[model samples]
Target chain A: MTLTEKVLARASGKAHVQPGDNVWVNVDVLMTHDVCGPGTIGVFKREFGQHAKVWDQSKVVIIPDHYIFTADSMSNRNVDILRSFVHEQKLPYFYDVIDDPTGEWKFDASKGQLERQYGSNYTGVCHTTLPWKGHTRPGEILFGTDSHTCMAGAFNQFATGIGNTDAGFILGTGKLLIKVPETMRFFLEGALPLGVMAKDVILHVIGEIGFDGATYRAMQWEGPGVYSLSMDDRMTIANMAIEAGGKNGIFPCDQKTLDYVNERVAENGTKSEFEPVEIDAAQVFSYDKVFDLSKLEPTVACHPDPGNRKLAKELEHIHLDRAYIGSCTGGKTSDFLAFAEVVRGKTVKIDTVGVPATTKVVRELKEILWGGQSVWQILQSAGVQLTENASCAACLGGPVDTFGRLNKPMKCISATNRNFPGRMGNKESEVFLASPYTVAASALTGRITDPRTFMS
Target chain B: MAHTVTSPVYVVRDNIDTDQIIPAQYLTLVPTIAEEYVKLGSYALIGLPDALYPKRFISEGDISTPYKIVIAGRNFGCGSSREHAPIALGAAGVEAVVADGFARIFFRNCVATGEVYPYDSPVRLCDVLHTGDVATLDFDVDTLTVGGTVYSLKPLGEVRPVIDAGGIFNFARQSGMIAGEAPSH
Candidate 1:
């Protein structure tokens, strides 16, 4: 049995657990959003005749990341109710839209001027902040109320999304049922060319694996090639693991991971030392897998379904009207730097949208734009729009973006998580999920083009 | 193989998410909604003088949500698979859920997360579902109806076999799927 198998088995409490066994692994971390939090709390008191907290306070995390601007009075009320609950419990972490007057939140909306009720400044998409602060470790199980909770799996842990009830028990008692997931090994081989990115790789994987093929499974990305990828790159891959129903996407701890941990520690006041990664003994992994990255050129998963994938070269004379980069996947400094490196001095021929999750990301982008980076100059010269202070704005269609008098059926290549129908603002519009480099190249060529082709 | 609960189940709107079913702030309240664990959590804090959001926080004794079937609008389970919803609903004394539609992923969560009965109505619109009617869900046929509208929900399938055997874990224990070698796929 491999480490994953052992953890799954132990978490599920089986005498001996094996692959393909479905058990509800105990949730190590549970989180929620305002829209859902209020209703969940309402049900808790209505049902259990009391508050449900009898479990570990350290384990459950709550963040009202979405609808920060208070979509309406009702939405605002919801955020408020969730906030009070977090304050009362003193749950180790709670990122609210309005910070307390006393000032103790990780991100204070009060600090920002434009951080409106539903503005982008309060909290980022839960996925962005979880991994950003080093709350996610390598091998622990994490369950988030949001679908993108699978993003934490970048640390080689089994992370997945769960509904509120599952979160309730994990919050009430330290246990929940879990299914032993079948391991789907995706072998990465050969170094990715300079222009291609992990987003492209993941999108390509999604295209091949199909939207529902890997549902409820663990995607273990391996091969020496994977090690070459940076932690940000790995995060991009793991972030969307949920697209295919996989529990989490993971990569082993290596030098890149160490660097990420070191940098994160220095940035935040958390412990600087890297805790030894936990390994699960007594577990076996399914060998069901696939490979062929050298042949795997940069790719995109097109509209309606993430499963609708095609290589950039497959679509001829592809003209993209919009290219968006910035989700938790593409918002990191590395993604921007990579895009800057590729599109240096080159202006976007098509309209572009760059949305970052955090103020820091915005600040970093501003520096790049003002620092005479070619990409920045080109973006300014071009009509690219930057929608700042929105969480999953472009990814989930919160109207953070609007193009004036554009064609009805707009086609965009983005570096977000899912490309499901209407995931982006335009339901009729076609969206192709891909890497930042691919998006930059697509922006330049007006169609999906091989990112490598644009390289110097 | 069947773990039977009471007959008439409480119906609910589709997508009664973990958050709605069990608010995150209240999760740590410990034995009483009236008591704040430490500081007022977000839900309560909203009622505070300085709330980031509106002040519609549910004060203690805001009419306990009556345990009955909740008839919801279409595309009910259209969000993350937060187990809190179902668990809270179950804890709230909801016998069964009846919805015109359910999010596909959340449907599976109902059966896996707890022992509650999740029934889908076949009718396009569960127009009959009122706020307080009892929801009777028949897992045997995988059907749910409130005030006469039947919901068409998918069967739990593999999960159903375990549920029939009285929860997946219990079923696994009885069948020795974990004790012995894994059953052949």
Candidate 2:
């Protein structure tokens, strides 16, 4: 059996399981954010009775990330609904956005967007916060309301996204009925060349297989290249498993995984014991593919769809009006480090925006130095407009005033995931999705660019 | 579960993602709320680019759509796991969607929520149908008729009973997977 099969089998208390076996698996952690939390809570109340409590408060995590920074009343009301639900159920894992005594959603537009944070209780994107807050564990079944919840699979777990209805059922039952997906093995070997990142690799894979390539299957990354990537890089790759219609994307847990999980868990003061599962020797993969990471160049997913693949160098003629670096996929410390390396001491030709994925990442940007200057200072000097608060600002194109959102029909090069039409605000606007290096280079030139021009 | 749905069809190209089905900016409207559910339907498919799609799926200031079926190319309802995609369509009175393929999560949401019937056509239906064309879907034989041409649809198989019973919760109750009766939405 593959690692996914083993993890599901153990979670279901079964001695053995196969690809197509439908079983009821115990859920270790269930997450919902502001977008889906209120709806899920409503379904829970309607189906389980208005007075019913959640099955287990400790295992339920609620993060208010999307649309939190906006002033939209409906968005604010949604967060309040989550707050009341958390208070009612005594759920301890809620990261709230409103800290006023009245519990009213408030934002100070007078302050810089970065300084407009409500309080420290607020985290940013849920996918990044899951690992940062130590909610992700190996061999655990993590279900979230957001599609990007598959990002947690990088921690060597069975993680997938479900809609509010399924989440509502899990809230009352602590169990989910799921079928064991067949595994599609991706054997990545060789080291990635400089200027190419995990985003490029996944974009390449998605392009090769098309968007629905791995539908109804688990994508398992293996070989030496998978081990060589940092935990952040692994997270970036695993975050986009759904782009290729994958049920989940998993990697074999090693010392790096153990070390990162242990550090975060210790810092969080949450005690969790989980067994790491490995692919059985007799395991058979339904599909197998390999990528030679060393030969990869900076890649991009052109506008309209993520699978519309193109090399960054091949699209230098595509002019852009703006550049953005933020989201659960690209707004990490590692991604910023890569971006700063290219944009350091250089001015941007286009309007460039930088948003950290979390409040912790916000601090890291101010503390982490490059060439005697902090990343924050370097980015500021390079003319990148950095937001003060760490939230998913404009990544999903929240409200009209959302920072960095494209309100007009203009072209942009972004480090975020998904280039679907209207994904970043305006329907007619085009987005070129690329790595931080590529985005940084493009910000400098005002056109799609290859990072190698700025590197070495 | 024998029924027939006849209505005007809205045609779209391949990869009609969830963002196009329901944009992220309007996601704040929770579908469980009675009024917001209708409000969500008002904005269904509003994300389609004006140049590509000249016709709107749901007209301005209207809560429900005139079209009951949506014909699409490959990979319909892709991107994002927002159940709002299916909910928005269902709230807009979309009874069925026929496409060459579907994204995994969106299709699951359609069945789990009992919002709409997701049907797969052996051929690309979008190529054969137009936005204003009339289409009739017969649930009994799993066939869609458009302009006197009949096309066979992939059977719902194991999931038919669930949709017939109005979603997973009710199906689970009937199948003994859980206790209690289905709630009235």
Candidate 3:
């Protein structure tokens, strides 16, 4: 059996489980954010009862991230609704944006786009926060309202997104009926080249097999190349599993996963008892596909869809008006380090935006130095508009006032995930999805340039 | 439980992600709110580029659409786990969606909410049928008739009971998984 099967089998309280079997599994965590938290809470109340309580307060995690920095009233109201729900249920894991219990929390735009909302319980994106807050554990089943919840599978756990109805049911029962998915084995061979990133690796796989390639299937990455990657790299790859319509993307839980999970769990004082799933000696991968990491170059997913793959050199002629580096997929310390490596002493030709995924990452930007300067200072020196407040600014194109949002029909090379029409803002705008290396390289020039140009 | 739907179809291309179904800017309107639920329908498929898709899924100044069914190519309702996608379609009175294939989350959301009957068709209905074509979906015989041509649809099979019971909550109540909860409207 694969790692997914083993994890699900344990969660479902079965000795052995196979693909295509329908089982009800106990949920360790159910996450929701501002975008879907209000809806999920409403469903939970309607189905369970007007005054009903959630099954487990500690098991439910609410993060108010999306649309938080916008001046939009409705977005603020949604966060308020989540706040009310958290207070009503006394849910302990909520990361509140405002101190006030009422719905009067407003985005003070006069303070500037990146300022304000300082030093609150606000943790940026939910996917990134899940790991940092130690909500992610091996051999646990986590269901979140947001699709990128699959990002937690980097811890070798079974995590996927569910709709509000399913989430609501879980709120009452703490159990969800789910069908076990078949696993698609992806073996990454050879060490990753200097210019290449996990974004390129996943883009190549998604391009080889269309956007719907892993639909209803689990993508499990293995081989020696898996160990070569850092936890952040694995998170970046696992985050975009949904781009290929994958149920989840998983990696082997090695020392890196253990060390990261242990530190976070200890720091956050979360439940530390978790049994990690291991592969048996007789285990076999039914469907195997290998990707040569060394053979890869800086790749990009062109406009309209993430499956439209092309090498960076092939698209160097494509002019770009903006370069954005942020989101759960690309807005990490590692990704920023990659960007800083390319654009250390150089200036950006086009408008570039940098948003850290979490407050922890925000500190890392100020602390981690490149050459002699901090990453934040280096990016600011390079004329990148860096946001002080860490949140999903324009990765999904929130409100009109969202920072880094492509409001016009401009061409943008982004380090974010999806390039679906209207994904990052205007439907007419063309977004080229690439890694931080490619985006940073493109920022130096007003065109999509190969990161290899700066690497060597 | 065998019902038939006869209505004009709204056509769309493949890879119709949730963002196109319902854009992120409007996601602030949670579908669980009845007032926002109706508003969500007003903007269904509003994210489709004006140049590529000239015909709007929901006409301007209207909350409910004239068309009752959607015809889409492969990989329909892709991207994001936004249940609002299917909810918006259902709110717009889209009774069913016939497509070549569906992304996993969207298809499951459609079934879980009982918002729309997501039918998998053997043939590419988007290519075969035109937008605004009058079509009839007969679940009794498991066939879709458009312009006098009949197309077979894959049976809902295991999920039939859930949709018939009007979503997972209702199905759970009927199966004694949980008691005292009213069915979804």
Say which candidate scores most in DockQ: 2
Which clashing pairs does model 2 show? A113-A388, A114-A387, A114-A388, A114-A389
Per-candidate DockQ values are 0.12, 0.86, 0.85
Better of 1 and 2 by lDDT: 2
* Backbone clashes, each candidate: 95, 4, 0
Candidate 2's TM-score on the B chain: 0.97
lDDT of 2 by residue, B124-167 (tens): 88888899999899999999998899999999888788888888
- Global local distance difference test of model 1: 0.58
**Tens digit of per-residue lDDT, candidate 1, span A30-85:** 76776456645653444333554636676666666554432234445556677677
| Pairs in steric clash, model 3 | none
How well is each residue in A15-134 modelled by candidate 3, as lDDT tens digits? Answer: 988889999999999999998889988888888888999998889999988898888999988888988888889989988887665546688888888765754677898999999998
Give the residue spans of candidate 3 off by over 4 A.
A100-103, A284-286, B181-185
Q: Which window of ten consecutive residues has the lowest lDDT sum in model 2 chain A?
A: A100-109
